[model samples]
Target chain A: MLGDNDGILSGAHFLDGDHACAEGAIAAGCNFVAGYPITPSTEVVERLAWRFPGTGGTFIQMEDEIASSIAIQGAVWAGAKAMTVSSGPGISLMLEHIGLAAMTEVPCVFVNVQRGGPSTGLPTLPAQADMMQARWGSHGDYEVIALVPNSPQECFDLIIHAFNLSEQYRVPVLFMMDEVIGHMTEKVVVPPRDQIKITPRRYTKLPPGEYEPYRAGDDLVPDFAKAGDGHRFHITGLTHNEKGYPVMNAECQEQLVCRLVDKIRTNVEQISFFHEDGLEDADVVVITYGISSRVTMRAIREARKKGVKVGHLRLVVVWPFPEEYIRRLAKQIEAFVVPEINLGQVVLEVERCAAGTCDVISIQHAGGAVHKPRTIYDAIVEAVR
Target chain B: MSMTPAVENPVEQLLRSERMPHIWCPGCGIGTTVNCFARAVEECVSDLDNLIIVSGIGCTGRVAGYLELDSFHTTHGRAIPFATGLKLANPKLKVVVYSGDGDLIAIGGNHFIHAARRNADITVICVNNFNYAMTGGQIGPTTPLDAVGTTSPYGVCERPFNLPFLAESCGAVYVARWTAYHVRQMTRAMCEALNKRGFSFVEVITPCPTLYERRNRLGSGLDRMQWFKENSVIKNGVDTRECDIALRQKIVCGKFVDVDRPSLLEMVEAKMASVLHRRRWERMSREQQKPIAMRPMKG
Candidate 1:
């Protein structure tokens, strides 16, 4: 489906990642945004506050990140395409609602412009430490889609995909942006409304009496029914049956949780997205995402000049982890060198996927700054050795 | 079974009948409050389809689950903000937050104050059972000083909050307090709150027989209701600051604050309209008065 034309900024402009993200959400038909100001992420909401009114959307600066996070979920249930934005400490406060969104299958977006953390370590500097936290921050067994954007353009482009994924899967989609990508300025070309593909919400077609809120079709995602649609549906954070009533038994828990996980796990092939270069004959693969992916390119160029058979695999959709693809690549490659802003997060996943079939070298950084290309170059060299 | 045409309960239509018998314990006043709420919903809300009940995690929070209207059982202390979002996202829907004292006044205190401050269009029904009965009667923000709970076995040293005072001071458009025993007055208060335009709060003081009553040796839920009936002073329009209830003290209950105020959405729309209008007028004037070269460059 085409997006609302009023929301589409169909022109080329120099924009920061944060402003681009705000435009992306508007273009994606997001009608509600609730956020609390946090450094590096405040610009996204600020732009939304300025633009939403003109686009017939609602923007609310909530009291705190906790309120901002759950407010978006409430808006989602009220039949709006909704989202919230925050940085590390704010996202930390939003963890509980992230679990709520997962359990209740509330389709919403959570944008985390990553900053150095371990308790507000660096408010204005870059880090990809939240890569692991995005997948596991919320408690219990559940699955969510996390997209990593490397540049200002990708920030605009990928956030739309994030909303679509969340709506299509009825899950909270995390758009992970680091401080550099969030603050960096570059040209962003927003396509026309008709040219942009948007996934409309899969609202249930069944009558009020027949519709079961949790009942899924062949896609394993239940069609949504909003609050005032006369469905009179009940949504709870507790383990529930198809009737949306709390069913406190192991059978129900196993069924609900497995479906919550399997819906994404089984459809990983369709959900996984990555950009690869020279992987056909390369001996070593460089695995990275977000800002590190941008840094990895420089290191890869230098390594290629040094006669190393190195390839770059940039992850766009980080969660659901592209396990099968990684496993297959592990069998073909000598080693996978993973460099990220974090100490060693996504590298753990690479190591697990490799399963000792091939070497997995982690290039760790203590955040506050992006990799010095030479650091990743050294890891690429060591992996080849 | 006497089957001379089974007479149905009128309130059953507003409740999830199959989900009952409810989880509320015997002699618990939460059930009584729910009944009063149902009556209020029936009285005030013309369109049942547009009513949404949101509750946080607590015994009273289960009100959302029991109610047949579109409902949400949210995380602990988050019902207010969640309801605020619902109301703002779709102005047609009448959102309500029903939860316990500990859920609303303690962990969710910030959200509570902010929502009231914004005058978000939603009705808040807080069931104050004095302690956290669901967690085995732990001392809470509203637990009376010198009262005994599992967490306050040595007697509570901290002063309990005057919920009506908090609601009024925080800018709630309608603020009222009632005991579970005062079903008629409580129902009327709920009806008024449900019909109010902005943030409205109704605090219902109820007995927790299993945990609170047992731990404090306060006889039973019936005895507590009897006490409420005997001790509650109906002081309409009294200052909320003078309505504090210490242990075994006279509970001042009535409609305290009722005033008109623009809701959060109302203010947002007004501000947006004025700013956008000014911007459009400025742009038009600039286009007419200045040449294209002299105009400010678009970013």
Candidate 2:
């Protein structure tokens, strides 16, 4: 039976992305999950419910997304690797707690299975419209790590990475999975527990009375202490001091919100990850992420056959924006083409990072489905023009 | 704190006195209730670190902020779910949800019944001041019928919820009620709730001196307390259905429900443990065999 130690399947399985994501979290030592079932995301919790008992984990079907979001944070503070999963409408309701998670610096994970939305736009349908929301959905000046997975295997791999990054930064890492990746079934090979490396929660070594919950060292990230661990501290949604007590003053607000944003921003090099193909000598580059990257791959290959010197840059970590790489690449590339399931979301980031150094072309899709190869091929053709 | 300190500081030890004197209004029952809560914790638990207080948004939600223990002042209408996570994640910790009627029952009512129905192992201290006290005396879920509120200036038209009935029907293992004036009883109830093993609820009718009391012309907080002393009846183990409070009417307060039912965690682990063990054994057997499988798929 799985204990506090090992629960990894350590074998290849033909699993849907949602199931693979669940195994990834379990393998990453996630033992507490509170979630509400929303389409394209329910399978993750369903599997956890089936697996948590002997696996030394807990799965709760909360009242709603708001409760689910805060519940995971509660679990996180109680010293469990915790997570919650939902699609667009549910994600909307969770926004407030997500902000609270940011404010309190609670290390947790949120899986957003991207669906078309203004409000419940399409439950089972695919969309990348939530890309911007993943960064700014919560009201406040805060940043979170967001990862996009294209296949079931990447879903397995990246969810673990998301947990690691979350623990390392003490931020709620957003696992931004689109409907296609979430519902897609493919082979995912989860390695042995010993082979997998995880970022354990950095518990404070300071004695109980000496410990301060929000006090950080030079890394700008503080170690955590669980509620019952004899470290008496307070956590609140309001702006707080280093001792974790709410202080409603401008100085405290500046001190707190700055660290929340800078913790991720300064460590962008450590957190930012992407896959680059044929970029060293290319004139035009095609950038994509999530399922959109897989769709754009066909267009890139087709464009290559026609002698277009267009390269591919697929983002595994979508925010902290990967600004440095985009800026540096923008200096050399003649143009950049971005195609996503949304009308246009990440393209705005690409254009912003490109900073008019080169032309940035956007291929828009309405998001009920993936883009046609011909359309992306045509966008690539136009970007290099 | 005042320029002149009070003769006796009952909550000095448990309250974050540096962050205080709290925002509770003059002659408010909230401060008195908080004092009782602190005293209850002091009596119940030898070790204070394991006690966690979580509160939602509102005047009563501010209770978590004043407590010196490990506390979480969470989002409005979310204290119970958050405490549910806290308790399940670490069973050793004693989790408590403290919030107001508006925050817990009006917007957050669904979670209240569900948590009680699931019999989540946590104590809930719901402070009912009759109206939405924080938002300036708006009609609330527990607002007595025909009472005056800012939003219901002509007197409230709707029937109020009998919180004890709601809690009892939803499967709480222990349920009780007391007015803020009943300090000793309220403190004892909290102590009992802290010791209870399953979902326990204690409803305290406190005076919202600035809002509920003033709008209803209930005179001062002192007057409200005096009225409670006159009108309240202690009916321990009474039928919850008849305990509802009405305007200028008899206020029935008591321990309404105390029974046995497995908590959500207990029920889940009990049902799933054996099946989970079989699967774990199967995984172990698989590990005893060939190499871990590997495959590559379309990307």
Q: RMSD for all candidates, in order, please.
A: 7.2, 7.5
lDDT of 1 by residue, B1-299 (tens): 67698788879999999998998899999999999989887767778888889999989999999999999999999998899888877777888899999999999999999999999988999999998888788999998888898877899999889999999999999999999899999998998888787899999999998988787788799999999999999999999999898888899999999999988866765676577767653543333221001111122
**Residue-wise C-alpha lDDT for candidate 2, range A1-385, written one tens digit per residue:** 3434466788778999999999999988898999998998999999998777657778989888888998898888878899999999999999998888888888899999988877879888999999899899889899999999999998899999999998899898899998889889998898877788898889899998899988998889998888877776888888889888878899999998999999899999989899999988888999989998888889989998988898999999998888998999999989998888887899999999999999998889887899998999998887776
TM-score of 1: 0.95
Q: State the lDDT at A267 in candidate 1.
A: 97
Considering only chain B, what TM-score does candidate 2 achieve?
Answer: 0.89
* Candidate that would win on TM-score: 1
Candidate 2: regions farther than 4 A off: A1-5, B1-11, B273-299
lDDT of 2 by residue, B127-201 (tens): 999987777779988999889998999998899999999999989999999998899888888888877778999
Query: What's the distance in Å from true for residue A260, model 1?
Result: 0.2
Winning model by DockQ: 2
True contacts kept of each: 0.82, 0.83
Model 2 lDDT, full chain set: 0.87
**lDDT, candidate 1, A1-385, per-residue tens:** 1225365778898999999999999988898999998999999999998887667778988999999999998888888899999999999999999999999999899999999988978999998999888999989989999999999999989999999999899999999998999989999999988887899999889999999999987778998999988999899999999989999999999999999999999999999999999899999999988889888899999999999999999999999899999999999999999888878999999999899999999898899998899998998888888
Q: Candidate 1, overall lDDT?
A: 0.90
The candidate maximizing lDDT is 1
